[model samples]
Target: MKITLFEQAAYRYLPPDFAEHHDSVCDTPYSLVTHDGMYSSMRNFLDELMFGARSGFDGIAVTEHAQSSYDLMPNPNVVAGILAYQTEQEELDVAIFPMGRSLGKTREPVRVAEEYSMLDVISGGRLVAGFPVGLSYDASLNNGIPPIDVRGRFNENLDLVLRSWQDPKPFAFNGRYSQYPQVNIWPRPLQQPPPVWLTGVGNPATMQLILKRGFGFTFFGFAGSKLTAQRIFPRFWELADEAGLEHNPYQVGFLQHIAVAETDERAEREYAEHVEYAFHTGLGAIPPQMLALPGGIDIRGVQALLRDPSDFGIYWQMRQASLRDLIDSGTVIIGSPETVADQLTDLCRQHRIGNLHALLGFGSMPRELAMRNIKLFADEVAPRLRNLWQGSGFEHHWWPERLGGTLRRNLGEKVSA
Candidate 1:
């Protein structure tokens, strides 16, 4: 039950005159006026992560998204690299940057793995690589790859990287998107094969793959509830067992948006603004037409969910409870330190969750408020949860710190510098 701070680095914009003049042009539902600048926001994020590490959080997590108001860190690897460098300077055991999107043609997965491997070597074996089969539009647009082929490409690319990492000698891979002949990747990861975590809404095939391959499975707890997670997680285990895997409970994780304040009332008040942004602007980024298709839930469905609201509701309301009717019932966890901690602990115990990815900075949340929640969670919630799994040996690590100093030094200052 190690506590971790997860940040999406949402871009929140605010200028006095632009709001009035460009309200029409700003059709997206997620943008809002915030006083903080980009660097200031990032600094605040880093400060929260540092505070989490110092206070007792096992690790800090960051993610990638693009061309939307939902998140700002389009290049999560750059942020991960910075955190790795800083963690080295401070000699902290904090693991930063666990998850990022898959690689593209221009961006090879092996190169990304090498970078993370170097970070692991430098960090003393503290890196966890989170690989995701990215959203259709983002992957297609950014990587010049079509959406239909994204999943296959993701799987193939991961296979290639894993083989490159594990294979002691030069090998050839004739993947759909990648083909190599007798070339071994340099600077192997410190954690043997390196820990890999897969993030997604709920892809059964993906879950089966992770379980079969002995990779960690992480679900974004936005669209569903703990019960839903509990249901899906066991199925993953069942599939793994069916595949003859030695059922390890440590292989499952869940992501949630969290806000903890000095008091419940204050927490609710402060978090309301972010809730509005998440539903109004965050969901508004996707065109209504795209979501209206079969098996698709449109922007209107977002509006409807916000309007009706459910306990263990959709992902949009997974953080802020004030704006909706169902507060305590849904995936969103918001309250004072004690209250939120109780909720988190209970959720984990109920679902038998091994890892909890506490998403702190999200939905246009102010950096200051986000940092406060991080500190509060680190100081209060984490210690209590640690009692649940004393002998489990569930440790968290970041890239740079995972790799020992000698390996890092051998790789040269420039490898991770």
Candidate 2:
């Protein structure tokens, strides 16, 4: 399996009762932050990513979140650029992944294409580009896109981006959301076109798009792993089967919040407060209306959600959730190396996940504690799960060629069973 360390640049010094006083996104007051505290939070986040690279993680990933205390990154590509150069200089053969620039939020698609191309060139063909349709709050409230049009805009921007990278000749492009006089990008990605990935949250339409377009699918386990997995994974493979597509595990990736220690009790004792902080003050504080605006979701989707809101497990209780709530719901996996590995292995094997994005840094966790989690996960847990799909006879076409991956040029290309 391809194991990556995912880090978010969450402000680490929020007051104990920050959640009670304010929301985490859009309207949160900046006055709560000190200059040095902000710098330290961001600086330490970068340092921890590099620490993961050096500690033997296969790749290091970051995400984009704007006007949010949970993740301060307005553009994850900036972090990816720095990591690209730094990893290349240090001769670290790890992938530089940006769970990256949101297509629906951006008015500039060419710039996004240029940035990914440049990152691939700098990282020496080691970019795993992720394109999320975008969160409702970020696109609609923060960037001022119509909530109903987000998916349409995302579809158009994605096509333009792929064409910008893959088209050999300069071409004029015309589309509903955007128009270009002449379309061409310099330093067009190093791996022909770097592997493409899309992020989703149990949307059947999104799953269909990922499968139909031959792109990788990433599911973030922030809601509740056990709950989401039961409903989502089965439906994904079922769709693949209906489409006559191979059920290659590499095509599916999962991002999970994890913490590990020498023993389960010790892990709970050390990480409990931070885990509660991550949920209560971060995701838990964001109101549900902000997450899904009235026009944001399709009518069918809205109806389904109304009937079965089980997909949003633990999210309703996140604002005041305890450590037990996080663990029992499987939102955050905390335990000894053995316990963590066993659970993760079973989850991946059962769900057929070939790429594992381990979120080791979160909440108000200190740099030392985060580093220790990364080190222990790398040294103890990663090795145990690396070979889970070793003899499965499937190839990782979703990864970079510089790594052990065999790139798939198109959806029609056969993948090994």
lDDT to native, each model: 0.61, 0.91
* Tens-place lDDT digits, model 1, residues 4-49: 6787665555332322233211243334534456666567666766
173-260 in candidate 2: lDDT tens per residue?
Answer: 7877789999989989998779999998889888988898889999998988987887888989999998899999999999999999
> Which regions of candidate 2 deviate over 4 angstroms?
411-417
Write down the RMSD of all candidates, one decimal each: 7.2, 2.7
Candidate closest to the true structure, highest TM-score: 2
Compute the lDDT for candidate 1.
0.61
**Which window of 10 residues has the lowest lDDT sum in candidate 2?**
408-417
Residue 210 lDDT in model 1? Answer: 68
